[model samples]
Target: MTISNHASVPETIALPPKEFSRTLYAYVVWGGLALALLWSWAPAEMDRVTYLFSDSGNMVEYASGFLTPNFHDWDYYVQEMILTVQIALWGTVLSIFFGIPFAILSSSNVAPIWIVQPVRRLMDACRAINELVFAVLFVVAVGLGPFAGVMALFVHNLGIIAKLFSEAVEAIDPYPVEGIRATGASKLQEIIYGIIPQVAPLWISFSLYRFETNVRSATVLGVVGAGGIGQILFESIRGFYYGETAAILIIVVITVTVVDLLSQQLRKLAI
Candidate 1:
């Protein structure tokens, strides 16, 4: 009786056998793709393992200079760091200002297909270009300083915020929008009275998060003559002032950490 029941259970619960050959074929294909990528782009003279072993001592010796960080120029560093923060602040504000309308236009539920496609494509173009590239272009057009950095961050972050905001808008509960329409509310009124309230917290949170990110990006923007601590850091590195570079890095790290923590707290509180 027990043997019959066990045999019947096998018939009831038949499972497909594992396909080891198929899995092996998949792994081979992936491995071949990886090899092709490496072959196409890797530096011609690069010997991955040999270089690390051969030049390790010199790398260690140079790195050792940064171990004892010198903060003798802390005052200048702090002043420039303030400028970086200010640039990021203005950039984030501009992104929010520009992103909101585009976000609405890009939302499938909110706008017609024609409006959505063009706005979304424009955002895609904005996001495809890196902040550094925008910074260089703006610097050439506007001629250096924090204005260029602000514009670069604004354009790049605009795309990111718009993409995020549209997703938030699309995910909103439909009932409120319907209720607003039932009252003969205009299209603009429906968006204002129904959609904005639902997504406002998330929009603010996203903006804060982007602001935190922009702070770090603004530092690098100065390297291209956008004007901030990055300029000093770049010069220090070029002049082999490892100590100053280390100090600047420390300040940036501390500032970023504090901002990140604060933003996280705000997100938790708001959400």
Candidate 2:
């Protein structure tokens, strides 16, 4: 028997002409588009950088005001901070309530295509629009207040929560679901007995996470007249109440940090 030294041979694969051409064309097209965008914006970008660098002292002066956060109107700042938390709490609760059903409807494994597609599209629309924009619209409709902030947070969070919950539903282990179905459980029963148990922890975790975000968003909504700490912050800035602004900043930071830590601990316990 002749021993062939074929093990050392390297196999070379050649790209097909069509595939090679397509790849080259894609690269060239993308590169050209990137270059075109850079060319169009380069001058303005350079000017912006130059302007910022040339007036760095003003930026430093503005930031320095926050160092000694004035708590002159501690009562008003605390009141608004509490209100922001309230708005976020209510928004998170409402979003979870509404989102659960939509989430079920949107899941491919749970609902028919007719229901899933429409529900998903609606969620897409809700998520596509920012909370600030929604807050603006609600302010126009409701004439400003925490109610508007709640509505904005509710709508936007619904979309996000639905998307997250649906994904959780879709990723469930099929064994429990099959067992429930095999036991002659109804569609709703199967989900309640199988799917809900599996995803409930995740859903809770998601809700808590969103609640934290909503707290921060509540402040921003206020700036747009939705009534929260953001409104106070906005006014302080506009009226150049740097000391009050600093105080509000301190309150917001402390509140958010404390809430974040609590949420983190709760999440750890949950899982």
Candidate 3:
């Protein structure tokens, strides 16, 4: 104690140097984002945002008409709504059938790079165009009907489902796959036994979610004469039958809500 135990004293430590590259990277990312927003502002017509407040009275008056919905044609609305659900169902089924193979092919872990790149690019092309555009084209090719709506939903959903499923495939635990390979199992057997089991739950969940989305999309496809409640909705709007339009919209909202709830439950069970 009298010696002060000078040899036991700890030395002060120095802090590590700050990473200039990380700081620079953060600044670059923020600067790019700022530039992008500024570039898009004028083109996006964001300056017209004030018009929403300025025209509030007109919107209020228009909305008031929807308050008193006419349910006189409820029977016909229900029938058309059922038809829309049917179209969505068929579209979702077809997409699931085709998406499985495409998903497998597009997965980097599952397929060669050559095959993955081309398949992914094709999927990108399919997804790039809106379902409405596909509906229009199919209507011209196959004539106006629910079939056009089904095809439109099929193509678009195929791209989405494949992308989602492939991601699930890629994220699977590699140990199971490696173990299967060690057993002298063929690649196909490894995928069938190891990969499919792991990804099946996610695939089912994805399909159910897409089915819910297809139901909503099918309603819009009727606007282009593809066939559904949307056709009736469009007619009501064009004829200025605001009350009927409101009723149709209410039915659509209720149906969508029910579908969403059911799909959510199914997804939970699947997971």
Top-lDDT candidate index:
3
Look at candidate 1 and give me any clashing residue pairs: none
In model 1, which regions exceed 4 Å deviation? 1-13, 16-46
Question: What would the per-residue lDDT of candidate 2 be over residues 1-271, giving only the tens digit for each residue?
Answer: 5476665644887765677788999999999999988897866675477767688999888888777788878998999999999999999999999999999999999899999999999999999999999999999999889999999999999999999999999999989999999999998999999999999899989999999999988988888999889998998999987888989988999999999999999999998
Per-candidate RMSD vs. true structure?
Answer: 3.4, 4.1, 3.5
lDDT at 50, model 1: 84
Considering only N, C-alpha and C atoms within 3 Å, which residue pairs clash in candidate 2?
none
Instruction: After the best TM-score superposition of candidate 1, give how far the Cα of residue 29 lies from its true spot, in angstroms.
Output: 8.4
lDDT of each: 0.93, 0.92, 0.94
Off by over 4 Å in 2: 1-46
Question: TM-scores across all candidates?
Answer: 0.87, 0.85, 0.89
Relative to the true structure, candidate 1 has a C-alpha RMSD (angstroms) of 3.4
What is the alpha-carbon lDDT of model 3 when measured against the actual structure? 0.94
**Cα lDDT for residue 215, model 3?**
93
**How good is model 3 by TM-score?**
0.89
